[model samples]
Target: MKINRCGQAEALTKEMFQKVLGEIKNDSHRLIFALCWYTTERPSAILQLQVSDVYGSARVPLEKMVIAARTRKDKKTREVPIATALRQELKAYSAPSEGYLFPGRAGHLTFSAYDKGLRRVFEKLGLRGFSTYSTRRGSLTTLSRSGAGIRQIQALSGHASLGNLQRYIEVSDSEVAAIAAML
Candidate 1:
């Protein structure tokens, strides 16, 4: 269905995201989807993450920390403080050291694979106009509407410049209503 990562795709609603999340049965795939929704980082970055990056040899608290610079697109490290629920999910997965979190036949799950997997989920749901960027975009839009400053959103997004982050947020009509209601 030609789901482009550019601005062509609109941010998905939480319910819609959940529906897609629910459809993914594989534990690795579920974690990938959850991480996309939770971290708001690039899907490729999440896919490139090693087992040690997520969990060390021993258990640890889910602190706000940079998820290894190796996987980052900008090559600039960014920190995401994950939720307790997601932490538990990661812990439950029990990954081995020195390997990609979501491994496929060709080593790690490629961007195309992640994109295609998500595409299949969306197609099954009869959804249109969403892509790899949807979860990240949707999270940013939600944060903006919830009264988070642009910089705060940028913190999670790791947007290199101020102008770059603005592109991810699509202001909604309800946001206008929210402004009017606040008066």
Candidate 2:
């Protein structure tokens, strides 16, 4: 399988995200896109999120979301902490406790549907070879380049090994040029 490089994935412009969000007619779709982009979660994990997994009171600002995920890759359950931006987005599109985070027409989200949505978004943007996994890769790349350590990223992303984490960190040509400029 061809994995998306971190550099190319991070290169996903804000305009692209906005365009995709705008194209989504349903409130649920927009919310799902926001969650995926903000949390850097795999579609499978994202699909499994429940309203109860989010821990914040209505009295307080919904800025923090606690996501409990059971990843097939890791075969372990992990909790991911998301920031206010994503939390606020989710709150804006809040669903009932029994509802799926990204409910489909059938009333529950599926991995295949999530994958198709991501592919459609990329296709609309004229970006080929991009997949939902790119979101996770982009998140890891952004954090790593921002000075986060492998251990930190591993913890946040639930990767089993540093080697797997390293695969997500793509050194870009711009980065190379920037470094050369300093020399």
Candidate 3:
């Protein structure tokens, strides 16, 4: 059997995801990381997110954030409900009332900057191939392995078809167990 090297990208377990989240010091960056894991948003779409996307108003309860059609790869808009716990964490963040979530020299953080930062952290932890894209891929794999239906996963990933979504998900050990148990 072929073994993945330290640098090769691998699907993450819940524990591994938590470890990475703890290591990241920046709240905005952490949110970005969490967003990628919690949903299948492309890095660019994440950078484009604004505070208004989440918190509707002090009076109105927070609701789902809409990923505008222009920002999505499929050119389809989706309203994603924010995780309740994540909402609390976001409430504590000190972002502007109106602006990009992670502003850089340009309007939003450059993809290079986000990638380089992630790579630096991955290298420090003596891991490889854990690029920015890995979060979404790992998340989808995780959801699938946990027995989430394919259609549900497809909804979150915004993948055009079942084939594309399946292409990225890895069969988890838990899934193997479940299948074997079925016999």
Candidate 4:
């Protein structure tokens, strides 16, 4: 794992992810975190999403939500397939017409605000070492453990390179032992 000044964010289990979701009372906030997990998109990019980006003209959720190049860290446009859970959230969410999905003073919801909200949820749930980026990291790790290839994950995450993407994947000792036993 790549160590950074702030330390790696803790990747959550499916149960922990669900706990976090249940803790968030606001529908928009819940959807935001769900998108973070399901889309593996950064909080900033998800916050900046326009209504049309995730919906069709008929107001149905798009099979793949468009992450414009301008909003992506890699400056490459990506189309992330919406997971069934996230599709349900989108169906229930009241996305604004022709504007930012999470509207704020400057246009979209600020990263700071999102972070603060998540921090509160984490604290209430007694979760530690989790951050706004945790869902993205957790989702990536979950996909890796579920037998997704590096290239396939890279396509979804829009990482600049495989090495960068690898840094996000976490391997537990139990998984290592299981692999050894199989071998």
Name the candidate that leads on lDDT: 4
Candidates 1 and 2, the one with greater lDDT:
1
Model 4 spans with C-alpha error above 4 angstroms: 1-5, 181-183
Better of 1 and 4 by lDDT: 4
Q: Give the alpha carbon lDDT tens digit for every residue of 25-97 in model 4.
A: 8777899999999988888889889889999886799999999988888788888899899899999988777
**TM-scores across all candidates?**
0.85, 0.75, 0.85, 0.91
Look at candidate 4 and give me any clashing residue pairs. Answer: none
- Flag regions of model 2 displaced more than 4 Å: 1-15, 55-72, 104-107, 177-183
Which window of 10 residues has the lowest lDDT sum in candidate 2? 1-10
Q: Write candidate 3's Cα lDDT for 1-183 as tens digits.
A: 113433435666667778887787777778788877776677888887766776666523266777778777778887887777567656767776667767888688887877777767777886665777778778888887688999999987788899988877877688699889999
For residues 36-145, write the lDDT of model 2, one tens digit per residue: 66766666767766665653445232444555534345666666666766767665775765545566677567777766766776777777656666666766677878
lDDT of 2 at 31: 71
Which one wins on TM-score?
Answer: 4
What lDDT tens digits, residue by residue, belong to model 1 across residues 1-183?
234544457787778778888898767777888888888887888988776566655645346635777788788877788778678778777565567777878989888877888888888888888887788888788878788999888877889897888887887788789889999
What value does the lDDT take at residue 85 in candidate 3? 57
TM-score of 2: 0.75
Please identify which of the two predictions, 1 or 2, would achieve the higher TM-score against the true structure: 1
